[model samples]
Target: MLINCVAYQEGKKLADIPIEDISEYLSHPKCFVWVALRDASPEELATMKEEFGLHELAVEDALRGKQRPKIEEYGDSLFAVIQTVEPHGDELTVGEVAVFVGANYVLSVRRDAQQGLVGVRARAEREPHLLSIGSAFVLYALMDAIVDRYFPIVDALEAELEIIEEKMFASGAGAQRDNIERLYELKRKGLVLRHAVMPLLDAMGRLYGGRVPVLVENCQEYFRDVHDHLARILGRLDSVRDTIGTAIQVNLSMVAIDDSEVNKRLAAYAAIFAVFTAFAGVWGMNFEYMPELKWHYGYHMAICSMVIVCGYMYYKFRKSGWL
Candidate 1:
């Protein structure tokens, strides 16, 4: 669907149009046109690209849905790409959102609109300020919404990590291995988001370098605010990654301690077994000259000696706190 927003000093409002009316709709000076397309055919995209006079590089970037997040200056406009993440089952589903921002209009296209762009587009229409605030505000507002979604995803990951951490303190190291896999997956998602956002920051800075047109300059602070928000979100992701690292280390450390305890106990038991085994082997020689074999109490005495030795060893272990 094509959405055109007219920005005024007080607020903004939007007008909806069919995709084919983009050319006619863009004729208005107040028109900040947004062409949000979903699953357009190659032919449709090619025609739109030519109509909008988009740079070949920008066109190529849009068609190549997996392109990294970036921003570039075309002749009179800036093209930016961002990745929006969706919660898909037990993991995140990522898709690209490509945008073209000019002095008068902004065009955004996504491979699929199910990732939440529809809600944002609807919001711009539902709210008066959004449609009237020019392309810059719209740009930042859209970015802000996407960034806001990341918070809940990250929070869920942190909560899961907390549970795993508690288990790390307990004796469930083997069972928590899957949690490490989940942590790694989250870190990978963060890495993907960083790749997409970092370039946009550079693009935004360069767009405002030295001087910007009055329209963009007026909204420069808004850009800066969104940049700050992106930075803070990235910082949270980094902290989550580090926390995951520490949790894994804690798990390993606990496993090592448990293994050491098991080895110490096994060593004590093995020593006791060795002493009794040797005593049995020597007495089993069955020489006719062995006098103790004739005494009935000899059997009891040997058993008693073995029990006493084991008891003494257990007492020593308890004293040393190795049991």
Candidate 2:
């Protein structure tokens, strides 16, 4: 669906034009059109293609909506895909935004993403000087908006990792299992966020460095600033992944140590029971050859002896920290 189709001239709002009128405004040298769409259909994209002269391959990719984050140039226009990451419930939801930028127009198609570019539009309008730079500045505004959204998510993941780390050494069968599961979940979310940022970083580099696009050449510093933000986000993402890996390992180690301790206690108890069973087995032999059978106190004396032996063994085990 077409969300908005507005034209701008010299960084000022010219008029809200219909999709069919886009070409008329494009005829003006100083004017540029910005079109926003949400889950656009084939017919809508076809219309856009006719109006803006968008590349067919770029339109197809945009229509598909799951393209990896990237940027490509076809003749004078640039096609860029950016992944959108949003926290939904306890997990992250991944979406895509494909932008087609040319000298006179910018077409943004968003899929599976709830966040919109209304704020970006407002921001660009407020800075007419920057907006006067045309579609390139608008592209930067959109990229900056998407990259800024990532910070809160990164912070959330880091905070979750910290909580999981604290629970790493916690003692409980259920708690240990929960900690491991949480760590894995955190790692998964980190990868989702990382996937969104990494590709965009590479794409942004193209805007600022060698043979930059004509529309973006003058805005190298702005794109560079965005590249720096993505770099920081990527760095933090790496740290989160590493910390998650370490947490998983440490949790497994604690579980192993706990199991080993449990086994030692079981062994100590088994040894104590063996001492009593040895005497009992000897007495249970059905034979007149059993000498203790003749004495009335034999049963009592045997029981006392078994108790004393088991008690001594229990004390030794306790002292050794195995019971």
Evaluated with lDDT, which candidate comes out highest? Answer: 2
**Global lDDT scores for all candidate models:** 0.69, 0.92
Local error of candidate 1 at residue 3 (angstroms): 7.9
Name model 2 segments beyond 4 Å from true. 286-290
lDDT of 2: 0.92
- Across 1-323, the per-residue lDDT of candidate 1 in tens digits comes to 33332333234444455556667756666665666666556676686776567787888778778877676667768777777777777766778778877766666777643665767766766766655677766677677677677778777777877776766666654655655666577667666666656665566664454776455665777677777777777777778779878877766777678788888988887877887898789888999989879997999998888889878978888788777
lDDT of 2 by residue, 194-256 (tens): 888988898887899788878788899998999999999999999999888888888888888
**Root-mean-square deviation of Cα positions for candidate 2 versus the true structure, in angstroms:** 1.3
Choose the strongest candidate by TM-score.
2
Worst 10 residues of 2 by lDDT: 165-174
Query: Which pairs clash (backbone N, Cα, C closer than 3 Å) in model 2?
Result: none
Off by over 4 Å in 1: 1-15, 18-21, 125-130, 176-179, 207-215, 286-296
lDDT of candidate 2 at residue 280, scale 0 to 100:
91
